[model samples]
Target: MSEKRRNRRIKNRNINQSEKSTISKRSKIIWIGIIVISVLLFSSLLSLQFLEHFIIVD
Candidate 1:
């Protein structure tokens, strides 16, 4: 009975580890998306200033 309990405990630990790994992977993807969006937004804001200056002169 004790041996069976030990095996079950190990199996549960492995399952928990796998779940944590999957969660981490998902979080990493989310962070990458956020970074890309932020870069695009900042670049557009920078270009808008240049466009405004040119438009006023023209």
Candidate 2:
């Protein structure tokens, strides 16, 4: 019985570790996506503003 319990505990630990790694990877991906999107939006906004300024000057 004790051996079975030990085996179950080891399995649970392995599962938990795997889950944590996946979770970390997912979070990293999400953060990278957010950063990329935000940067693109910021660049677009700046370009628009520059274009508007040029039009006004002309």
Best by lDDT: 2
Runs off by more than 4 Å, candidate 2: none
lDDT of 1 by residue, 1-58 (tens): 9999999999999999999999999999999999999999999998998999999999
Error of 2 at 48 (Å): 0.3
1-58, model 2: which lDDT tens digit per residue? Answer: 9999999999999999999999999999999999999999999999999999999999
Candidate 2 lDDT: 1.00
Question: Which residue pairs clash within candidate 1?
Answer: none
Per-residue lDDT of 47 in model 1: 100
Clashing pairs in 2: none
**Candidate 2 global TM-score:** 0.93
Task: Point to the candidate with the largest TM-score.
Answer: 2
